[model samples]
Target: MIFPTPEEYTVLVLSLKVGLLCVVISLPFAVLLGWVLARKNFRGKLILDGLCHLPLVLPPVVVGYLLLLLLGRRGFLGQILNDWFGLQIAFTWRGAVLAAAVVGFPLMLRAVRLAIESVDPRLERAARTLGANPLRAFFSITLRLAAPGVLVGSLLAFARSLGEFGATITFVSNIAGETRTLPLAIFTYINQPDGEAAAARLVLLSIILSLGALIASEAIARKMKT
Candidate 1:
């Protein structure tokens, strides 16, 4: 109602956009990584798993800096992207999505991996014996069985992305319309002398969002069980 101002609304929408984009961009990769970790045995698997989780252990600021180095215009990959594709990530909404994906991916991957591992390999084998291909068997048996975990993982990732601040701010800066998100906006409001009310509103919105996600995840899990 009389809560967030227009600027705050813009930040909220931007945060949701970044969060959704992060989820969409990372879901396929997260599912693949999850399946790999859950089912595959390969050399350096531990290293790969650790690398996927490095963002979780490292400081958000450090993660942000790393993204900046890798995706900044002057960085190697960034330079190539700019020169070859005319794409830019630094200081843009896309950069915010990238930061959110980097941080949220581990949670999604872990959940999906656990879910995939929980599925019965025998069922997949049975599907294969019934003339199904590997991909078909996986989708019909393994992925169907793991739907609950996938939903949980996605919700967790969404929640994490919604709250992302340090990495996003570092990689994308705090541009008002382009990159500012709810957490960044809250931080900005807190910095101003008369911004306590707005900051409080944003904090409340964050809590509501987190709670809603949890509730929705539980509902999805229940629906999948049925």
Candidate 2:
């Protein structure tokens, strides 16, 4: 398409916002969990890892329903959040972010864990011998070397969020200017009478955005290797 309609622009901007927020909000946790899973051998570690990756195996609709049960307005934790912080996640843009984050988290965590695992443990220990503490060694050596994987994971999460649909729809209900991301917008257009043109535009936009991210990821990976 040459130019996007205002609605298309809004959907594009909202999708970008959700995708970026998903990565920002989830990255720290992914990094920590990845580090733990890669470096530690604690009790129930396998269970924890499985739980972290559960979203990957479960249906996206099921994941959204679970979130709704936990964070919906009348939900148990949702009630507490609403009463304490005036936060309402269900049927809102914030819920969209949460849904995208949950769905994308497993990919993020797996990439980070594999990346950290690829780093040599002896290098961390060697830093310890040179007066670096664990955190210092990790920040300076281990994490630095793992930057490529982290970049890849972040891009993967962002791409996943951009295309997220079932979970977002179930959790946020596809309100325009709120929860209507690109995928949701496309779904809306597809269902409306004589909306094929709009839907086609969105589908093309989705392909372009996803392809751009993939290309950027590949370029970054290549740069990191050299």
Candidate 3:
């Protein structure tokens, strides 16, 4: 296939950038949450699990709205952040990253939790009995054992972020250079006169990217199982 046009190329790159940033920012926290959910039997565990998976079942638009209420210019945290740190997140690429992260987080978190659960706890305990600290055993044993799931989760999150539309558009307003990811660009094209051709091209791109990411994820999962 011919390369995408300069404008289409920009949107493509932006989608990747936003998706990767989302995963990078959220992965650490997702890993921690996944480990906690998998290993711990604490009070409120049910509530915590529900909250971790909330985005998976909630409407994407509602998630975006909730984010806006927390991070908008006049929002409570938003006002504090702006006044104290001069940091602005809403309506920027940073906000796009935040939107993608929130929407994609549950997928990553679930993948991690399942991966950790599949590991035999005895492996980590053996390491602990051999003089490894809990943290060391986790890093050397449980974490390594769960690497495949973490990889799959990362790819899945990347795919989800690439296709993210409702939350991203609702939060960031699709400014061309700053926040117009592939999905936003596709949406713009579909609504314009004689824009179907361009929209079709982007839609094709989206399908290709999604399939590629999932294929890689499946490959990793299969490799890990072997």
- Model 1 scores worst on lDDT over the 10 consecutive residues at 1-10
Candidate with top lDDT is 2
Query: Best to worst by lDDT, what's the order?
Result: 2, 1, 3
lDDT of 2 by residue, 1-226 (tens): 5899898999999999999999999999999999999999999998999999999989999999999999998899999999999999999999999999999999999999999999999999999999999999999999999989999999999999999999999999989999999999999989999999999989999999999998998899889989
Q: How many residue pairs clash in each candidate?
A: 0, 0, 0
> TM-score for model 2?
0.98
Best by TM-score: 2
Q: Give the lDDT of residue 125 in candidate 3.
A: 93
TM-score of each prediction: 0.97, 0.98, 0.96
lDDT of 1 by residue, 1-226 (tens): 6766788788888988998899999999998999999999999999999999999888988999998999899988899999999999999999999999999999999999999999988999999999999999999899999999998999999999999988998899999999998889889989999999888998999999889998999999998899
Native-to-model Cα distance after best TM-score fit, residue 171 in candidate 2, in Å: 0.7
**lDDT scores of the candidates, listed in order:** 0.92, 0.95, 0.92
lDDT of 3 by residue, 125-159 (tens): 99999999999999999989999999999998999
Cα RMSD (angstroms) for every candidate in the order listed:
1.0, 0.8, 1.2
Better of 1 and 3 by TM-score: 1
> Cα deviation in Å at residue 164, candidate 3?
0.8
Ranking by TM-score: 2, 1, 3
